[model samples]
Target: MQVAPRRTGEWWISPAIPAVANAALASLWAFTAFGGWGEQAFCGVDSAHDPTCATGFENAVLSSLAVVIPAVVIMVSALVLRRVRHYPDRLGMMLTAAAFLWVGAEGIVFLGGYLAQPS
Candidate 1:
């Protein structure tokens, strides 16, 4: 028995599509963070009436981690897709892309709301 050749299109489909999709998501994140959307306060009183307060140092560290963790996952997945030969990479790529977009959107919404709040 002989192994069949992988389709030419498969080479382009798995890695290329996800790369473009994730890049777009990254750009959106940049825009949200720096496009005069709002100042992102990682640690502060959520509201005047709130009984709890987040220490600035702790919030900053945790918030940074929240962003970093997903970013690391995205980067790792992209690297994996580049080297994977036998498995279909589409599912992993799509899932990572979705996560990228979701995180970006959450950041945008969080900052947008913060800016919208009345001073």
Candidate 2:
């Protein structure tokens, strides 16, 4: 008979669930965020003719800020909370930090694309 591992006291919940869910969400965001999907969706294919459409520069800046700011906040939170009383769910915290790092990477790529765009 196969034996199951003993359950630990504090962290009964598995970290993989949230980690996978977040990963999936991040991927969806990446798929939609790049290639001017937001602008196209909001202003249609001919965004230039749409008076309501924000400039590409504006969209890029806002997108960068949106991800980067949250990434900073999540990173800060993970570091700050890590110093407190020994946390049981270290794996969960690490996964959270990893997710934000992914976001930070996306933000960097977005910034690069933004800079490359013609004014």
Candidate 3:
């Protein structure tokens, strides 16, 4: 889960980590779509006639709001849970691991995208 700072000014749940994860996932998800998936459906959201912000996964920067919102929810919820009793420590670690996996896969795709081009 999430752990809030204990009397510290710093936020225990880092936004950067999740932001990076979001970027990676969004990029991978978008690039995979290529010409077909873009402007279609994403995150179970129906995007019809909307391109700029129509649930399209074209760019992570553009999709940051969509990704960050959920991540922040989870982080905040986890932090609240951390304040309460009976919270498992592995939860946060598992999510973090999943994020890493997502980043790794996206990194591979990103590399392929660049290397596949003729420079």
Local distance difference test, each candidate = 0.48, 0.54, 0.46
Task: Determine the C-alpha RMSD for candidate 2 after optimal superposition of all C-alphas.
Answer: 8.8
* Candidate rank order under TM-score: 2, 1, 3
Instruction: Estimate candidate 1's alpha-carbon lDDT, on a 0 to 1 scale.
Output: 0.48
lDDT of 2 by residue, 1-119 (tens): 22234475432545555467456746655664655554444445553545334365346545565565565565446446645214536755665765766666566545644453444
Give the lDDT of residue 33 in candidate 1: 46
Pick the lDDT winner. Answer: 2
Please state the error at residue 13 of candidate 1 in Å.
4.9
Task: Report the C-alpha lDDT of model 1 over 24-118, residue by residue, as the tens digit.
Answer: 76565545444522233432343542212223223333454566457657566655664542354554455466556556555644654454444
Q: Model 1: residues >4 Å from true position, as ranges?
A: 1-13, 39-65, 80-91, 94-116
Clashes of 2: 0
Instruction: Estimate the TM-score of every prediction.
Output: 0.43, 0.44, 0.37
lDDT of 3: 0.46
